[model samples]
Target: MRPALYWIRRDLRLADNPALHAAARAGRPVIPVYIHAPAEAGDWAPGSASNWWLHHSLQALADALAARGLPLIVREGESLATIVELIAETGAEAVHWNRLYEPARIEHDTRVKQRLKAEGIDAHSHNAALLHEPWTIQTGTGGDYKAFTPFWRACRRQAEPAPPLSVPTDLAAPDGARDLAGAVVPPAGITAPLDALDLLPRVDWAEGLRRTWQPGEQGAQDRLGGFMETALADYREGREQPAVAGTSRLSPHLHHGEISPRQIWQAVQTQLARHGAEGDRLDSAEMFLSEIGWREFAQHVLYHHPEFPDAPLNPRFADFPWQEDPGDQLLGAWQRGETGIPLVDAGMRELYTTGWMHNRVRMVVGSFLVKNLRLPWQAGEAWFWETLVDADLASNSLGWQWVAGSGADAAPYFRVFNPIRQGERFDADGAYIAQWLPALAGLPAKHRQAPWQAPASVLGDAGVTLGVHYPHPLVDLKESRQAALAAFEQIKKGA
Candidate 1:
């Protein structure tokens, strides 16, 4: 049989990978390859933290494929040129890969597929990341759903997602493949060592990220197992509390395609059955699945609206008067966790330290950036694109646009979140704040969330000195909020 190249992209796992399964089942010797092509990713290429995770994830994938007796070929270049060159050298008849939804990727993949087919090589793509392709789900009028509720409802009405493909345990590789295990140029042109990707940081800034995450398929499974055992029951409320480990930290893994949503959905169902979970337990499981639905919804929006990463979906937002942060001092303070708003500061600090943050805290900080600070949502999005390990274009775009009231089903522009009240309600005990903002650790729970409001005695008792140990709020919450509202009023009138 002629050889086939299994092109690995986001789908980096052995199991539940449709492209890999198809390649193996073609009765041809399969050569697995990962092409490092960051330039193809356009403006939102993997960030520093994401690159770190990608390095580890690729290493893990390489090891797994090697153990299965298939050497994963690592190449670097324009994807089509590299793959076409590989085909010529290996005498391969086919190339297969799971699809990616980002606009640039879609354009590149389409060109490659057409070019490969013109050369009479079988070029195939499969759906592995999402439960269903974005175009497959639609409203009764054959239009994309603008709101999440109707979209998810439509998804639920469809047939359940196909069962995940089983892991390909035994596989045959092409001729001379074993000899090509570590070969940089074994008749297939140039290849780079995994280390040559420059994915790791030169300054060793990721110790906290290393301690907090394990970035591969096994790691994803391990995280899911732990979540089902301990946190799935309280996910509804526990996810809201930052101090508790009530949420599944599976986002980076999911973003990397080390694990599929199908695996997660099935795993949750099986776990529920094993424990005979009912009542609130079942509700929590459903809520967790709905979060997964939101991920699908984000992708759906991105696929239909390819301009999602930069532009507002709602046209009226085009005229919104966003504040200009001269010299970016406001943005700098927010990014560095010196905003003097305890919860927002703590959330930003947690992200800086661990490359991750709690979901509720993410919302609070997002609101503070766009609403309270009246800054451009694009600024916050860019910062997150640089810092977050799980910075998916679809989700990041949806989140920032949603927070700014410029996207589908967005929060109203006038509903600015009061960081103090948000802190009091969510981080009621202030444990989340104290953990990240250690200077406020000695303050009472009441004062920790809003030390500016605390009496001079309380501040003194906590050993805190305003503008010395901690800065005052950058903008007065009340005054800034009204200014944001006034700006919104101007845009509303223009509309």
Candidate 2:
């Protein structure tokens, strides 16, 4: 039998990989390939931090595949053309891959599948990313759902997600397989060395990323285990506190296909079974799983509305008067974590240094950007795309739009976050603020939340000078809130 080619994309793990399992079950020699074609992603290509994760994750995947007696072929160019070339070179009769939901990827994959099938090649795609593929769940009226509550409830009413597949023990490599133990030499220019893809930054800005994350399957499992052991008991309350390691830091792992939602679901189910269903454990477990539901909801929205990344779901936002930053002065300040709002600054700085931010702080920073600064949400969305290791187009777009009050099930336009109040409520001890904004460390916890409000004597005692040691609040909170409300009113009237 001819060899089968596994086109590796986001799904990078050996376990619970449906597409890989199908290829292995064919009883044919298997070849795994990763094609680097960022341009094919359109304007939403993987950002710098994402590329950094990809570089490490791919290296990890290559090592794992080598242990299983297969070599991972790394290539660059158009995905379809490269796949066709690999098929010809390997004489592979089948190409299998996991599915991706981004607009550009959907279009690209649809064309590739149709073209390949027309030419008598077996092209199979599977759902290794989402517990349930987007189209499988729908509203009673048979229309796509715009509200998360209904959407998630519908998901829960359906069958539980299937158990994840185990790693395959039997595998065979095709003839002329590249040696995984040493330097790769491309055969007739069909493949490139992983380094040739140049996914890493040229300037070495990723030291912080390296310190903060482990990028492959083993890392994903370790993170999951830690979360279950220590954090799952208090997740409902602890997740709201940014200073605590309360939530599972498995996003980058999930985004890179290092872990599957089904795997996570099953893990949580096992925990629930150990502790019966009527206590804090059950509540916390359900809360954590609901977050996974939100991730599913984001993908569902994007799959149904392909214009989601660039356009607003609520049409009124089209005429919304977004303030001009004029050379991005406000945007730049926010991006660099100099916004003078303690919680927002802390969140932004944490994101820049760690390539991730706490969920609670993410909401505060996002609200400060679109509501207080009055800047366009897309600016914030684009910045996050470049800096976040787990930047998924669907989730990123949904988050920004939700903050800007322009997405489905969005926060009300009038509900502007007061960063001071948010900080005091969530980080009442100032630990989170002190960790990220060390300049304000000496101030009282209350004063740390708002230094400008502190007395001059307090500022002096702390060795802080507004606009010198720490920036003044970029915009007066009360004034910005009123201005944002007025702008929102204008759009409401027009709508």
Q: Candidates' lDDT values, in order?
A: 0.87, 0.89
Cα lDDT for residue 152, model 2?
92
Prediction-by-prediction clash tally: 0, 0
Best by lDDT: 2
The per-prediction CA RMSD against the true structure, in angstroms, equals 2.4, 2.5
Per-residue CA lDDT of candidate 2, range 1-495, in tens?
A: 888989999998999999999888857788888888999898888999999999999888887887766778887779999889888877998999999999899998999999999999999998999987889998888889899999999999999999999987787778764432234433322322567778899999888899989999999999999998899989999999999999999999999999999999999988878867668998999999999999999999999999988998888898888898789899999999998988999999999998999988888999999999998888899999999999999999899989988897888888999999999899999999999999999998889999999999999999999999899989999999999999999988633
lDDT of 1 by residue, 124-224 (tens): 99999998789999988899978999999999998987788898765777765422234443323222358877899999999899899999899999999
Residue pairs in collision within model 1: none
Alpha-carbon runs more than 4 Å astray in model 2 = 178-192
After superposition of all CA atoms, the RMSD between model 1 and the true structure is 2.4
> lDDT of model 1 at residue 300?
94
Error of 1 at 215 (Å): 0.5
lDDT of prediction 2: 0.89
